[model samples]
Target: MGHLKDMVGANVAELVVVRHGETTWNATDRLQGQAESDLTEEGVKQAQAVASRLAKTAKHISAVYSSDLRRASETARIIADAIGCPNVTEMESLRERHLGNLQGLARAEAHLVEPEAFKASISSDPDESIPGGGESLNQLHLRSKHALENIARNHLGQRVVVISHGAVLRALYVHAKGCQPAGRVRNTSINVFRISASNDWSLSLWGDVNHLQGTNLLRASQRGDEMR
Candidate 1:
């Protein structure tokens, strides 16, 4: 793919992790864990920005993977087109954390309505499950871990891009950086990591949203250099 020509080699696979472009729910601050939503006009532009920037990585990405969710799928399509990748592969393993009962609730509403429950659910031990049919943080960690390992093993030396939901990325980052999973990930943020030749993974950058530096699409909720 055009976005990955510079990343193929015999040493390690450079992994480019990007959150999907914005959706209506995203703008509304709606919780969309495992919920399917389409990209908004702003999201299309955001994905284009990512493609414009990543097209320069020159890493020969051997493969492209995206969550089956519509927003992620659409965002992946834009990147694939920019990089000339023949296809975008859909992988269910990359879906967002199942928020279950919290699926459609607004963030503020959830917090104000159930502060204690929300706090408990997002504590240090992500294993705590949410109300309704949501999955425990542990489950999220396990699925994402399995998916990442599989990708590393199957495409050891090839660079790849994964378009996933915010929660899925958070789980991955928490595991990679040994941090607590809470808060939000910026829209269209790019995180870079690599599967080393020694069979270890290292995160190079987290939540880089520089591509939106001069764009008018910066979310109203974001401030300064942060993509909140």
Candidate 2:
């Protein structure tokens, strides 16, 4: 595999993409879409575990990029420290899908925050933006693809880690797989992919949580809020 990639030279880039560590919102079944949430104690431990996992890979990471959101920036910093990177790049394009007025509310209370939008979001059309400031699924797909392509293009031959949110990660997976949905992504789970010069993405791994085996926090629900 190493030689095969070398054959492509700088035309290919290796990416290690991960969802941010679990947050208070994640723990409470609240919607975190584009909202702020501190990482819980367990979340910090999860980040440490993933950091340790990346430290053992022996790959020279060129950079660490994450969403501007606190949860993701925090996770990226943890990973960057373990990998000896001194800085993290924050990008809003990598943010979770905007959940509009429903953000920060528990699933049970989401309807009350934005009744119509919440109901419409359940089965919104690809182009139909969720009411109350939310983006459409199509918008997310395009943003995910463009954000990843930009990252791969900028890094070229380097290997880098990108920490983002569940919704953004899921959008990437869906876009790469022709919009086919994958399983739920757990906090701190590792995902790997390679991007060709043509901007095509080949997934090498998805939602691997082996590093969290002993943490007893590997499982993540597939519910809508959890996905966000």
Candidate 3:
């Protein structure tokens, strides 16, 4: 771990949050939810690009944490190698929101099959659950917040990187910023947050994909299973 306690004072921690690279589901416009998918070739490049960017930009990254999902873990591994970090701590709490029956459906198919359920799943209602089995947005918020709080507390005065899914990242963004994120989170995009000694959080960056410029891997349809 690379501690920056001396440089950053003992009370503050900077958390760098990254969404995993695109998976085959993402390319095909399918919902992955808790279901798993392998990263596409472009996804691998995106991960590598972001990893290189972080290695060049971040002064000190004490730890790397990732959702245990294969997509996220793979991205974290690439980044860990780029940053010379030895290991990544995997946390199930950081996984994507479970979409239940909507897990593998394409967006259009989901709407066609169960419009009402789809609407509810995408709605802002924190308590609304997707049909079948899965977590509500409110439930997601709680777990995401709890996971982030724990990480911040444990790594105070250090810089840590967290690799997670889109929905989970949105939940955390709303928790920190008190507003829905402005747009879709691109694959391997970086979001920066500052955690005060008291654990109060502030967002400094969100959905930044400048590192992916010229990669030609950006997706056209922002609508996806995990995001909706």
Among these predictions, the greatest lDDT belongs to: 3
Candidate 3 residue 129 C-alpha distance from true site, Å: 1.3
Q: Each prediction's Cα RMSD? A: 3.7, 2.8, 3.0
Clashes of each: 13, 0, 1
Better of 1 and 3 by TM-score: 3
TM-score of candidate 1 to 2 decimals: 0.85
Q: Which of the two candidates, 2 or 3, achieves a greater lDDT against the reference?
A: 3
lDDT of 2 by residue, 87-179 (tens): 999999999998776777788877887787787566557787777698888888899889889999988888888998777777788766766
Candidate 1 lDDT by residue in tens digits, 1-228: 223345355777777889888888877767777777778898899899888788775456667899898988999999988888989989999988777666677776876776655665566666787777677879988999778777777777687888887777777787677874445677778887777666576787778777877777666214111112
Candidates arranged by lDDT, highest first: 3, 2, 1
lDDT of model 3 at residue 53?
86
Q: lDDT scores for all predictions?
A: 0.74, 0.79, 0.84
Cα deviation at 74, candidate 2, in Å, is 0.4
The TM-score, computed over Cα atoms with residue i paired to residue i, of candidate 2 is 0.91
Clashes of 2: 0
TM-score of 3: 0.92
In order of TM-score, best first, we have 3, 2, 1
